[model samples]
Target: MLKYIMQLYKSKRLKVKHAFSSRQGGVSQPPYDSLNLAYHVGDRRDDVVKNHKLFAYEAGFDFKKLVFMNQIHSNKVHVVDEDSFLVPSCDALVTNLCDTPLMVMSADCAPVLFYDEVSKTVAAAHVGRKGAFGNIVKNVLDVMWERFGAEAENIVVAVGPNIKLCCYEVGEKEKSEAKNLGYGFALSGAHLDIDAIIAHQLQKEGVLKEHVEFLPHCTCCESERFFSYRAQGETGRNAAVIVLEDYV
Candidate 1:
């Protein structure tokens, strides 16, 4: 029900609702200039909380049911239940329970949301290139499969908007990081496709290519719409959130 919203693939199957929010529809000011969902990005805490309330209202969830992480760009996945809301500092969250909204923040890093219709479980992950190098997607799949009885084949994934490869130019240092992880190849000039790397990891983990939907909105390129950390240093953060409601 959010004004600025993008639906995921098979969203209706889960009987839940979600949105990949853009830089529209909230109350932050220039530099952060509207709809910034992060508190640590130099925005006032009051504004951030107010923005969260507005976002929750628009996204069709109660503010109390929403949960956020401190996201450190690591491969850490938080297994969230009723008690998990109080703790922060993890980069990903998985919930089989209902009514709790799981969210991941990103300026350019990939925000991946997963749902298992058969099991009625949901998860959200923040996949920065560092996280990609850490194989965050693989870790998420492993946890979903191992803990929640979520079969990889039945796990529906939606990779939300992020910086694409064209504008996501990296240095040799980033390339080295990827190679050090033993995954992904280096181009001659040190550029890497973080999105491609994520997709490959998903497929390797057994998620069907068709089931994994990508938003394909490049944050850096589409500056008018989405936020980009690379392009706008210390700018606002766009959030990708999903929640299961009692009714569709």
Candidate 2:
């Protein structure tokens, strides 16, 4: 019984099935409690696997077909198919294969999902400060277009919950790096709006504003409903998953 928060753009688009999972209806106890979908965290492997199965079942996809990334906060985008499951050291995954889900795990880091209706391709990116600074969105879009024939305008982007500016404090070094990357400062030089930065990157990459949807709920602020690494130093992660529907 894994509960999910659906994205309207994904729901309306018939080519894909996508959901951003919340920290609810899971079996993990205490800190990881209820629906933690990541395995890297301290949550029990059995609980994480069960949670994945529950979420996959609820989202109308086979758990076995789900592919996950060993997110390292990098700009690496892995192109995947049925045989290319379980990628290591990649932050983004793209696939045109039907029934294969591309999933990204994040706590405070942003999870961005992409669906290209024209190409019938889907991708998920784990975007944090480093990835965003590295323009991971552009990298993903480039992969979708070059590798899968996806167009920027035809792609619907959904940015799931992450640590917002109100709660995301950054060091001066990070601030300098973000500023150098053209992502402006926030909170009187104390915070960085990584979400806004991601959105801006999407628009810069020629993705229409109307096609980009943002789930503005901050993970740090809404700790009860979503896991936040900033809020809880060592915590479980939420998942953003998308799959191309199998057509007979």
How close is every model to the real structure, measured as TM-score?
A: 0.90, 0.92
Model 1, span 1-248: residue lDDT tens: 23544322223333458877888887788787678899989998888898888888877877887888999999998888766567567788988877888889999999989988877888899998888888888888888888888999998888888888778787777777777776555333556778788888988889988787787688999887888988888799999889876655
> What's model 2's lDDT at 162?
86
User: Model 1 — TM-score against the truth?
Assistant: 0.90
Could you give candidate 2's per-residue lDDT for residues 166-247 as a string of tens digits?
9988898988887776676432468888878887888888999888877878999999888898998778888888988867
How close to the true structure is residue 9 of candidate 2, measured as C-alpha lDDT?
A: 23
Which residue pairs overlap in candidate 1's backbone?
Answer: 29-33
lDDT of each: 0.81, 0.83
Positional deviation of 171 in candidate 1, in angstroms?
1.2
Determine which window of 10 residues in candidate 1 has minimal summed lDDT.
Answer: 6-15
